[model samples]
Target: MATKKRKKISQAFTKSQLVKEISERCDLNKNQVTHVLDEMKDIIASHLKKNGPEKFTLPGILKIQVRNVDAKPSREGINPFTKEPTVYPAKAASRKVRVTPLKQLKEMA
Candidate 1:
């Protein structure tokens, strides 16, 4: 048997892409840009889960927020993986997002 090799995709977009963007806008290295983005993900996830999403603004970046909502499980009655019939229970959850693009994005296309 033969195994196929797969290409590796850099995390949070390619390092080159991130490094180029960050380097063009700020005095940061490729490694620094990578580190900052990784840390930012942790911070965002933690805030949304623990303290709730907060509206924040970074230069040239959009505002972000976390919204809590009551989520209802599938009422259609079905087992997705097996396609068997079943009732899905309702639940709650918090959804996080960047809201700044709402208006501009809607207007674009």
Candidate 2:
């Protein structure tokens, strides 16, 4: 049997990537983009919990927000590798994301 090689993606895309492109076009550094991303992540999480999923749009780049989700009880399954079945009884909340494609970005690709 042959094994397929894995490709590694950087934690943050290269300086020439889309996100970095936006950062540069907006006159911000890559680190600034990372900082904004981190802060926005926490803000979205809090908004989802407190006020429910609220839609936040970034105009042209991307829209970030949360949507209301239900917690569901699920069944357990066995780990094929170990052959041990484990049940998780706790209910889990489902989170989802929606990305609005932009015309410029679509053309860029």
Candidate 3:
């Protein structure tokens, strides 16, 4: 058995390049590929929205979850570098998206 050698990509693929590659491999037109990508964006957005499920999973690729973070009050903390007391501003509570790559995606890396 022989394995194929793939080129090492130095940088991330641009959207155009990604669309082209997906279109080629999937035997779909570029326009269709673009539309599918756009739809996926909408699906993810709606699933992760405030009133939605707060979780979106692309099976075999990754899982996306929303996490609620609590607000932090302003406090004095010691600066490690300067060895001085400094006041850190309070941070507002917010929701954050957490994306975790699954087994298949991790294996690809």
lDDT of 3 by residue, 1-109 (tens): 3344556778899999999877777778999999999999999999999999999999999999999999999999999999999999999999999999999999998
Expressed as tens digits, the lDDT of each residue in 2-97 for candidate 2 is 334534556766635756765656777888887887897787667556465566665566666555478977779897888999776767787666
lDDT by residue (1-109, candidate 1, tens digit) is 3334534646665667767776556766778887888898777667656465465544354566665565766576778799999877677665646456555555654
Candidate 2: where is the Cα deviation over 4 Å? 1-53, 94-101
Question: In angstroms, how far off is 74's CA in candidate 2?
Answer: 4.6
Looking at model 1, residue 61 earns an lDDT score of: 46
Give the Å shift of residue 2 in candidate 3: 18
RMSD of each: 11.6, 11.6, 3.8
Clashing pairs in 3: none
In order, the Cα lDDT scores of the candidates are 0.64, 0.67, 0.93
TM-score-best of 1 and 3: 3
Instruction: Report residue 9 deviation for candidate 2 (angstroms).
Output: 20
TM agreement with the true structure for every prediction: 0.45, 0.39, 0.81
